[model samples]
Target: MSLVDLIARADERGLAASGLACLDRCVPLLGGDDEVLRPLWSSLADGGADGDAWGERLAKARAELDCADPSADTVPGLGPDPASGSGSGAETETEAETEAAVSDEDRAAALARRMLATAPGDPCASALRAWADACSAAALQIHRLLDVAADGDGPLVAAERRRQVAVLELLAGRGAGGLRPALEVSTEGRRVLRAVVSRRARGRS
Candidate 1:
């Protein structure tokens, strides 16, 4: 099914996972490490039945990610991911040149931050649906902004679109069982964005 249709038809847990996965993949733009949002993901794994834990985890993730020094958001080698339940591997992104170029990257990062900031503490259906849709749009924009190749739907953006669709589909089909694979997809995207950010940072230095 199309991503929009899948999201519209999704249940509360599906909606929450959809949004979390989108933001998780874009974590690098916020300068958060891969595991920084693991707590939030864990809260979703049980299908968000525990509203209290979800809220607490959401607050904790925000606290860690909103630090002034984004580079040090998470420990380098954290324990097993709450979502993945196993070891994981990485992925890369794009950047522009002076003025406009730098603006594109900054804009991308800002969009990513907005995604994290706007995440609902309550995890209600209405709130999650809206947040999920917004995250989807922002994540795509971030990829387009940083896309090294400016061609129509560069690989970065294209892959992001696919990942978004895949996340929703996984949740739709496997329900709670889908969170693991959905998380794996987001994790790969996170590594890719980290590489892109790293390469761009190097170019500036």
Candidate 2:
């Protein structure tokens, strides 16, 4: 089924998992640890998105992402390396490069954090649908920002859309049992993104 069809049919748990899994897999873009969203997954497993444990776990995940307080509204800076030296042309170039990289990372982190923050604590069908749509847009935007390709409608965007649909379909078809397979799909995407980041770094060097 198409992602929209699958999402339209999904219950609250499947919808939530679909969005959360997308963000969880993209955690690497935000410089997050791989297991950072594990607690949220446990909450989904225990009783879906509206479970008692979900809010607390979600808060914890936000905190770990340095987005604990929504009011903070600040993106963490990627500071210049101490060893890069001071007041030299090379140092200035390095600082500019670092800032640019940080800006991309911050943009990705903000989207991921928004995906978490916007999750309905007591998700209804309407709320889940809205969240899912927003996640689809955000995930695509994240991929676009990180993509090395100059073309906006390149392979990265296409792949992200496919992954998004696949996760939702996996959940819709298999219930909670689909979580592992969904995660595996996310892992593969993460590896692809890591390679992109590495290639960018190499180009810079």
Q: How much is the lDDT of residue 160 in candidate 1?
A: 92
lDDT of 1 by residue, 152-180 (tens): 78999999999999988898889889989
Clashes of 2: 0
The residue-level lDDT of candidate 1 at 202 comes to 99
Q: Tell me model 2's lDDT, rounded to 2 decimals.
A: 0.73
Best by TM-score: 1
**Best candidate, lDDT-wise?**
1
Segments of candidate 1 deviating more than 4 angstroms? 47-50, 67-102
Local lDDT at 204 for model 2: 71
- TM-score for each model: 0.80, 0.77
- Residues 1-205 of candidate 2 have per-residue lDDT tens digits of 7767877888887888888877876777667877888887878778888877887887777778776653332233433212223223343565666666676657676766767666666667788777777677778877887776787767888898898888888887799898878878877887787677668668778
For model 2 the local lDDT of residue 89 reads: 33
* Count of residue pairs whose backbone atoms collide, per candidate: 2, 0
